[model samples]
Target: MRLLWPSLAVVLLLYPALAEEHNYQLAGPAPGSIRFKWIHGSICAATNRDPRVQAVMYNEDTYILRENIAIHYDAPFTYLLMGNKGALLVDTGATEEAEYYPLRATVDAILKRWGDLRGKTDLPLTVVLTSPEYLSENQGYRQFVNRPNTTLVPLDLAKMKAFYGLTDSWPNGTGRIDLGGRIITVIPTPGAHKDGVTFYDSYNGFLLTGHLLFPGRVMISNDADYVASLTRLKEFSAQHPVKWVLGSQIDMKFLPGVEYMRLIRYKPDEHLLQLEPTALQEALATATRMLGKPEVAILADFTMRNRVGPDERPGRRPANLPRIPQLPNLR
Candidate 1:
């Protein structure tokens, strides 16, 4: 880190605006276009030809990469943010085989090109997971192991808390990472997954919530914990302006209160991945109202249901578990 400081200082002298807060005009090309059409998987896997990983340059300093749905059903979205001194990677996608997935190769290519373009080389890379509990989201982590100048944060909750400086006020206060001048704030949002977290990019006002607040089925194990996490998110959003709520997956369809069948490779009428900032407030309200409801609350943007557990069915449940209805077909 210290080795890159001199170069960063030189760049700062040339660009004085970055010395203060650097406000980036978030999107690239237009309001909707993001490099290439998102390759929502094919109906049949045998003929699928989409790249194992699809990347879109959100901006010069930011890139959004989604694993091809054909390669993995989850096809989680991984984010790469470039800073003057270093770079930050959010989550690694599912697939593990290099011949099939090649996540690290793809990322290396992107970084090399970006470094050449910016005349910066060997910028330290830091990789962090949204939630270590999700296996598919972190499966591709081996691609980064022993890689030069990279740090893959461990999956242990204790280690993560210590690394992010949230040991004292975990799941309550915030932690941060300074990627050079850009500081991304980290908030604990554990409900859908106990180790869940949401990251806020200070430059673009993008709130990257992994599974907690996506536009899909948000399965909750503990309703009170989920509600409390949502409250924390709501309070944080009140203080910080959020531009986009980006989730890892988009299972919900265009139809309100409906999601695509689980493990379906193809989704033609899928809902948009990016949700408006108002979504946070809306989600909080809906979750609060469904705190003790017996039905699976389905909203236009998202559906709230209980995770698959012994007491997850439609019948009577313990006071702690949220009332959830029966499961549906397909998804």
Candidate 2:
């Protein structure tokens, strides 16, 4: 009986992880259904404020506790909107199980949030692809293509929707979606994620960068395109001061909280708080130094050319992957 109790407790603890393998009942359109749950990643918690409304705040990674509208959910992260007007979604979640990268439940959940936005005046929603990897863009075509309310904007429609079914109306690269009062703008910031698009929210001074701008690690994108993309972001930030930088993956310390981003330039705008030049310089310096490594540079290049990031190799070097010439020993 003593052993039985222990065994039962162990089984209970394993339920949630096991449940992921099987299809679980989704918390569809239920009023006041906004609930936040902690999922381990750079970002600690993802809130499902209905489907049309979602947000993610990094616990430790990137800017501390910076919140952004999460577009889709690949289990961990979800999409977010900037007010009721328009939204910039980072990743495209999986579709169906048998499909290429079946995480469409996230998108299905998103569309159901505001009921039906199709032909309903203005319910602007633009999806931004931060990284152009397989999982990032695959299996997410149906939600954007068929949805009546949301607009599908891709940098390279052929590259973004390579394996998925796509329609001719899908906007490629630069485009704009009117989100009621605000506008969601898609600016192509390739490199970090091949053909990855960085979203700019002029209303809130928020930049939704999927995996493009991580705080702790070096901003590595070996491909010239990816490197150029980050450079573009830096230039944009220098010109148009951004108060907050929202990213998909990050490693942070807090459970759940919001952090203030130091605005370097653009005068004290209404929505953003001004940051000291020193702080901004330090943050950018740290980010720049990390990516300066040869290995990191190589990895970034590989990510851009092959449209893939470093693979998880347990004990051996990743097969056929590019190797950094003077790689630093990463623990």
Top candidate when judged by TM-score against the true structure:
1
Give per-candidate clash totals.
Answer: 3, 31
TM-score of each predicted structure versus truth: 0.83, 0.46
Which candidate achieves the best lDDT against the true structure?
1
Q: Per-residue lDDT for 199-240 in model 1, tens only?
A: 988777788998888887778766777889889877888877
Q: Report the lDDT tens digits of candidate 2 across residue range 214-327.
A: 321223454455455656666666766465565553322121111112211111111122222233344344335544434322221111112223432223333544333666
Q: Candidate 1: misplaced stretches above 4 Å? A: 1-36, 292-294, 307-331
